[model samples]
Target: MINPNLALKVLDSPFHHTVIHNFLDLDQASLSLEALAEQEFIPTESDLFSYSASNNLSISDNPDIKSLYDSLCSKAWIRKLESLFDVSLSGNVDMAAYVYMNGDFLLPHDDELDSRLLAYSLHLTPNMTLSDGGSFDFFSSNTEGEAKEIVKQVVPKFNSIVIFKVTPESWHQVSEILSDVQRFSLTGWYHG
Candidate 1:
């Protein structure tokens, strides 16, 4: 179940972002993790990123995956997000499961895509530490909105959801995974 008194603690140094710990109840989070393991993930690579990812969860047949997606689209959830982020949403959300093993990494880039008002990652990797790598690095941007330097690093925590406003200045990347333990997460964007 969604945490009723979820607090949106905003981070403002490099860019605007927010993280909510224990976003889901224990049972739901465990079930979601199990469902993710059951999905088919394909190795995907580009000049920007290298990771294994399943297709969009919006069309997933798995009941747990569907439930998770449905919960994000629910009016209550949307309203909560809208209130926290201070933005109007169309209730349109896109999500996919990702697994980054050792050597996988994503290059820096701003998520300024069409209609993508906010981006999020629901971390499922338990007991992950800095030594495990796959940390989310946020970069500071120049006056012209170009990525400058990484100003902060957020280590993935279990059952935590990190959301950030998608803008030209929202430059961030997933650092290389240095351990055999895979970094598992549900990541996507909420459209306006």
Candidate 2:
């Protein structure tokens, strides 16, 4: 249920990233949303992030979402990502469901990790606008290599996906949710 032909726009300036719309079939997406709705979200708070997230969703009992997660970690999807980012992926992933309720936000930081080669988010917040304030942002660096400010903002759109190369310059953050509605997403890192 994947659309391999969807526009994969690459932005290299602020640490490589690709934005993809219509990432999955409508039916599959609905299954994911249903599974997410049944899961218990735990509050996760840290100096770096504050939000409610499900425990590693890969271990979930929901066959639909689990099957979808398995497919995303398959060789086929890895190849698609490789073609888009022009980098190899080891077919390993760490994923979880996130719910950013009102005022919940993740502070700015590079998702640079030795094991992670790419970071991604499959957004499921439908009908969200910029005014909603729960957007995904990628930060650009100043000439001195310091993270300056956000260069791109991807609004929470249902069934869209965003993937970024995990370099030190891959700093990014989730803006605080201003609206009363929860911002939902299934996010993870592709490891190499």
**Model 2, span 98-150: residue lDDT tens:** 99988899988888878898998999877999889889988888776667998
Report clash pairs, candidate 1: none
Candidate 2 lDDT trough over 10 residues, lowest sum: 1-10
Tens digits of lDDT, candidate 1, 1-192:
766767767777676789889988888899999999998999999888999999889998898888888887899988877887788999889999999999999999988899999999999999999899999989998888898998888889899988998988999999999999889999999999
Give Cα distance to truth, residue 145, candidate 2, Å: 2.7
What residue pairs clash in candidate 2, if any at all?
none
Residue 181 of model 2 has an lDDT of 79
Worst 10 residues of 1 by lDDT: 1-10
Clashes of 1: 0
Judge candidate 2 at residue 180 and give its lDDT.
Answer: 92
